[model samples]
Target: MDVLVLIGRVLFVVLFATSAVNHLTRSKAMAGYTASRGIPFATAAVLASGVVLGAGAVSVAVGLWADLGALLLAAFCFSAAVLMHGFWAEKDPQAKMAEQSHFFKDLALGGAALVIFAFFAYAGHDLGLMVTGPALSLG
Candidate 1:
């Protein structure tokens, strides 16, 4: 079970880690798209989000300060859903559907991150090499 949990944690963070890499490596292109969505300081925002997400992914994967990592992941997911994948703002049916899918995906990821946060922050469980203590104590 511990091994499985470890695997799950690593797998879960893959998407986010990959996205973080893209945000850093392709910042200019991503910033253009972000700006097209009317995000202010799109370039800086992309770089900042990349750093946040990369740090969160590393924290979770290594089971170090995972509670804090979960919070960071949740924040990024929720903010991106609202700020980037605004389905309601789309006009074309296909585009709306695409945005809606992305919006829901981010929401689901955010929800899962919150659940992980609760487990580490409150339940105080450990799996595999997970740190024995949580970085947060919000019960």
Candidate 2:
């Protein structure tokens, strides 16, 4: 069980780290994508996404406040799957496949995050504060 948890944590870290790097390095593309999706502020949106991904990666990697990290990541994946991926699902075949693949992947990640959140909750991790509102508040 311990080994499994470690492996799961590692996997989560790797996933979020890769995503963070991608969002950071490809800010222009990401911003354009967000704009295409009708997001009001593309640059701000990309930066915010990068921050969430980075914070989640760090939290999961360090195993310090991982439940909050997981919840934040869950929100990220959920929004990406529902808003971004869902919008592309029926437009183009290749795009649709990619979006669907991402949708399922995010769904799986969200499930894993929930599991981690549940574990932490049972272990007395304070999750009430983690999920109170938006993961990032620009204001």
Candidate 3:
């Protein structure tokens, strides 16, 4: 059971962890896209975003201060979805559909993070400020 929980934690963070490296390696291209979305200081934002993602990934994966990690991820994901994936603002049908998908995906992931935060932070348990173990478990 503990092993499974740890596996789940690893799986949850793998996407962000892998993408954090990509974000840094492809900063120029990513920043260009981010700027096109009207994000100010696009290059710096890209790098900062990468850092946030990496931090969140590490904290959550290691189950150390996971609530804070969850908050970081949730805020970033929600903001990105709104700023980058505004499907309603797109006119082209295909483009709108694509953006909608991206928006939903981000929202779902963000919502999951918020839920994780609530579980560890608000639940009469750990308050999510600190994690005593490497994984969350019913035991």
Which candidate should be chosen as best, given TM-score against the real structure? 1
Task: List, residue by residue over 1-139, the lDDT tens digit for candidate 2.
Answer: 5456657677767978888998888988889888887787888888899999899877765566766787888889898888777835477888788889988998998888877766664652323323232232223
Over 8-123, each residue of candidate 3 has an lDDT whose tens digit, in order, gives: 76898898898788788888989988998899999899898999999889887777867778788898899989998999999999999999999999999999988877665654
TM-score of each: 0.94, 0.79, 0.86
Q: In model 3, how large is the Cα lDDT of residue 50?
A: 92
Question: Candidate 3: deviation at residue 49, Å?
Answer: 0.5
Question: Residue 130, candidate 2: how far off, in angstroms?
Answer: 18
lDDT value, residue 109 of candidate 1: 100
What is residue 14's positional error in candidate 3, in angstroms? 1.1
Order of models, best TM-score first: 1, 3, 2
Worst 10 residues of 2 by lDDT: 129-138
Once fitted onto the true fold, the runs of candidate 2 whose alpha carbons sit more than 4 angstroms away are 1-4, 87-89, 124-139
**lDDT of the candidates, in the order given:** 0.90, 0.74, 0.80
